[model samples]
Target: MVTPVRVVIALCLLAPFVAMLWVGSYAKVDPVFIGIPFFYWYQMLWVPLSAALTVTAYKLWQRDRRGRVAAAPASSGASPKGGASE
Candidate 1:
């Protein structure tokens, strides 16, 4: 079942890709940032943005994986010794 948390994680991973891929949106030289052209500065801004988004996605994935593992049921016949022989 797809959960809200999974949807959020997907957005986190997709945001940077969508922003960076849409080059034409920030292809202008106006709205300069600290003397840097919008074209260059815009792309540079995503460097940090992408890193933060990627970290968030990774952390969310780890949390989800841990939750799944914890919720799994153990085998009924399994022994504490893992069925090992003396």
Candidate 2:
């Protein structure tokens, strides 16, 4: 069930977690940004970055799902509304 698209989607979803989990890498007061320390700015930076990555992952998953749905054979007996009709 694994595909390149899924792998990319996983990476997109995991990048922020990996970045934020490695706290030692950003635990520093140097490299201030307009008075904000690297530690604070770096964590804050991931807010938008995480959102972007999450969106990317979601889009990729959606594309992958669409591909699978298109490739699969349609069910002939299924009704559009799942309602019994005369």
Candidate 3:
């Protein structure tokens, strides 16, 4: 469980949760805020949150790839040009 991989999983989990919250809040029949409507804010808020979530996921994916590369083992065998029978 690399940190980056963990972060990616967290972000994937968070996006849907946040979206649900926004949807639920907007679903109220009246859907009003202090002055603005819940419907408007909920949708607008998600636009930025969606971008943030995407960026977070991308960053985490890159970090995970870096970790995998660092942990990769060296190749164990010679090339075919060596031409020897086993």
Candidate that scores best on TM-score = 2
**Model 2 misplacement above 4 A:** 75-86
Candidate 3: tens digits of C-alpha lDDT, residues 1-86: 55747866687758757776766656653656667777777777777777777787778777776766565543524333333334
Q: What is the descending lDDT order?
A: 2, 1, 3
lDDT of 3: 0.66
**Mind giving the per-residue lDDT tens digits that candidate 2 earns over 2-77?**
8899899989988998999999999999999999999999999999999999999999888887776566556544
Off by over 4 Å in 1: 76-86
| Residue range 1-86, candidate 1, lDDT tens digits | 79887998999999988988898898899998899999999899899998998899899988987776566556454334346334
lDDT (Cα, 0-100) at 17 in candidate 2: 89
The better-scoring model by lDDT among 1 and 3 is 1
Per-model lDDT: 0.83, 0.84, 0.66
The worst-scoring run of ten residues by lDDT in candidate 1 lies at 77-86
Give me the candidate number with maximum lDDT. 2
Weakest ten-residue segment in model 2 by summed lDDT: 77-86
